[model samples]
Target: MQNVVIIGAGQGGLQAAMSLRQEGFEGAITLIGAEKGLPYQRPPLSKAYLKTGDADALSLRPASFFEKKQITLVDGTHVEAIDRAARRVMAGDRSFDYDHLILATGTRNLRPPIPGAEQALDLRTLDDALRLRNALDRPMRCAVIGGGFIGLEFAAVARALGHEVTLAEAAPRLMARAVSPETSERFLALHRDMGSDIHLGDPVCAVRADGITLKSGTEIQADLVLMAAGVVPNSELAASAGLAVDNGVVVDTRMLTEDPAISALGDCAVFPDPVTGRAVRLESVQAATDHARLIAKRLVKQVDDPYGAVPWFWSDQADCKLQIAGLAAEGDDTILRPDGAVFRFAGDRLSAVETVNDAKTHMQTRKRLAQGPVARAALEAAEFDMAQV
Candidate 1:
C-alpha cells in the first residue's frame, strides 16, 4: 500500500503513524483528529497535569518530530463520512484517498443522562483540563460523578489541592469494573483517610448548578462538578461506512476488519483475545501502542502474526499507585497476598494480578502472563510468589 489514512489523533492514532515509519513503510500517512494541537497523553490530564498544569510535558512528540517523519497531521478536523466504494474519506471540502484505511477513532467520555449534566465539567481533553485547572485556582467544593479511574484520579488531586472532594459511584466499590473487591476496598480506605467523602451504591441522579442529587435522596453541595463516568467508543463513523461494529469496530486476530483493506485499533477496535479467543476491547496505552506496532508490521513487513500482547494498566491516586497485569473478566476469583498483591483467577488459570506501589511484582507478573496462562496450582506451589510463577 502506498497510502494509509487513519482516523483519530489520540495516543493510538499517533502511535500508528510513528510505528509505520519505524517499520520502514514509505507510504503516504495522514493522521486526522478532531482535537487541535499536537497529540498528548490523556493519562496525565488527571495526574501530573492537574498538579503542575504542564501542557508541554504531555506532548507525545514535538512538532519537529512529525515534520521529520513526513507524517501529515490534520488536526482540528472531523471525518464526516467514509466513501467505501471510492476508498476516500471526506472532511468538509477536503478529501483523502487511501490504499489502506485505519480506524483509530478512539473514544469519548460518556455523559450520563441526568438533569443539568451539561453543567458538569469534563476532563477528556487538554482544553477540558485547562478549564478545570482554572476553576481550581481558588477555594471550591468539588463533586465528582463516577468512581472509575478518571473520577477517582481527579478527586485525589482535588483533595490534595485542599479542595473538599465528594466522590459518588453507582457501584458498591471504587473502580469496581476494573479491580477486585479487595483492591477497591483498599482504595476506599485510602481515599476516606484523605478526607474524601466516599459515596458508594448511590449514583448521582441529577447534576444541579450548585451540586448533585443522589439516588438515595441525598444532595451534596459543591461549587464544581466533574463527570468521569466512563467512555464510549467512537465507532459511529465505522458503522456508518458499512463495517461491522460491536462494542467497538470488530476485527480479527490480525486487527483487520472484514474488509482486508481496512484495519482498526486502540479503544475503538474489538478483537479476539489471543489467549481466551473472546472478543475484548481495551483502553490502555499499552494495548493501543502494541496494536499499532503489530498493524504496522503487517502493513509494511507483511507480518501475519496475531496480536497477543498481554494487557497491563496503571492508575495513580494520591500517593498510591495501582498497577494491574493481564486481563480479568467479571466474577473472577481473587486471592490477596500478605504483601498486598491481589491475584485474579478464571477457573483454574490466573487472569490478572493487582498490586499497589509494588513495581517489582507488577513487572514480574506482566512477564509471566505474556508467556501463557498461569495455572492456579503453579501459583499455589510458588506460595503466591509472582517471581516463581
Candidate 2:
C-alpha cells in the first residue's frame, strides 16, 4: 500500500495512522475527521472534563506528534462519498485517493423522538461537554435521560457539583444492557446515596424548555436536560458506499470489509466476537485501539491474524470505579462472589467478571479470561475465589 487514508480521526483512526508508522510503513497517511481540533479522548469527557474542564489533558497526542510522524491531519471535513472504482473518497470538492482506507466513523448520540427533544442537550462530543459544563457553572436542576454509563457518569458529576439531579431510565434497572442485575443494583444504590433522584422503569417521553416528562406523566422540573439515551453507529457513509452494514459497518474477524482495500473499526464497525464468534460491536477505547493495531499490522507486515483481544470496560461514577473484564451476553448467568465481585457465565464457561474499585481483581480476571475460558464448576470447586480457580 502506497497511500493509506483513514476516516474519522478519533482514537481508532489516530491509532491506525500511528500503528502504521510504528510497523515501519513509510506510506503517505491522511487522517480525516469531521470535528475540528486535535484528536482527544472521549472517555474523560463525561468524568474528569465535566469537573476540571481540562480539554488539553484529554488530547491523545500533541500537535507536533502528527507532524513528526508524517501523518496528514484533516479536521473539520466530513467525507461526502466513496468512489470504489477509483479507490478515492470525496470531501466537498476535494478528493483523497487511497491504496487502503480505514473507516473509524465512530458514533453519534441517539436523540429519541420526543416532543421538544431539541431543547435537550447531548454529552457525546467535546463541544457538547463544554456546553454542559458551562450550563453547570450555575446552580441548575439537571434531569438525565438514560441509565447507561454516560448518563450515570454525568449524573454523578452533576451531583458532586451540588446540582440536583433526576435520572430517568426506561429499563427496570440501571445499565440493563451492559451490566448484570447485581452490578446494576450496586450502581443504582451508589447513585442514590450520592443524592441523585433516580427513577427506574420510566423513560422521558417529552422534553420541554423547563424540564422532562417521564412516560408515567411525571414531570421533572429542571433548567438543564441531558439526552444520554444511547448512541447509533455512524454507518450511513459505509452503507451508501455499498459496504455491508449490520448494527455497524460489517467487517470480518480480520476487521476488513467485503472490499479488501477498506477496513472498519471502533464503535462504527461490527465484527465477530473473538471468543463467542457472535457478531459484536464495542464502544470502548480498548477495542478501537486493538482493532487499529491489528489492521495496521495486517497492512504493513502482511499478517492475516484474526482479532482476538479480550474485551474489557470501565466507568467512573462518584467515588466508585466499576470495571468489567470480558464480554457477556444478556442471558448470561451471574454468580456473585462473597466480596462483591460478580462472575458471569455463559453456560458453564466464564463470560465476564465485574468489580468495583478493585483493580487487582480486575486485572487478574482480565488475564484469566484472556488465557482461556474458566468453567463455573471450577470456580464453584474453588469457592468462587479467582486466585484458587
In model 1, state the lDDT of residue 193: 98
Off by over 4 Å in 1: none
Root-mean-square deviation of every model: 0.7, 0.7
lDDT tens per residue, model 2, 203-262: 788998899999899999999999999999999999999999999999999999999999
Write one digit per residue (lDDT tens) for candidate 1, span 1-389. 89999998999999999999999998799999999888999999999999999998998999899899999999999999999889999999999999999999999999888999999999899999999999999988999999999999999999999999999999988898899999999999999999999899998999998999999999999999999999999999999999999999999999999988899999999999988999999999999999999999999999999999999999999989999999999899999999999999999999999999999999999998888889999999999998897
TM values, all candidates:
0.99, 0.99
User: What ranges in model 2 sit over 4 Å off?
Assistant: none
Any idea what lDDT model 1 has? 0.94
> Model 1 misses residue 364 by how many Å?
0.4
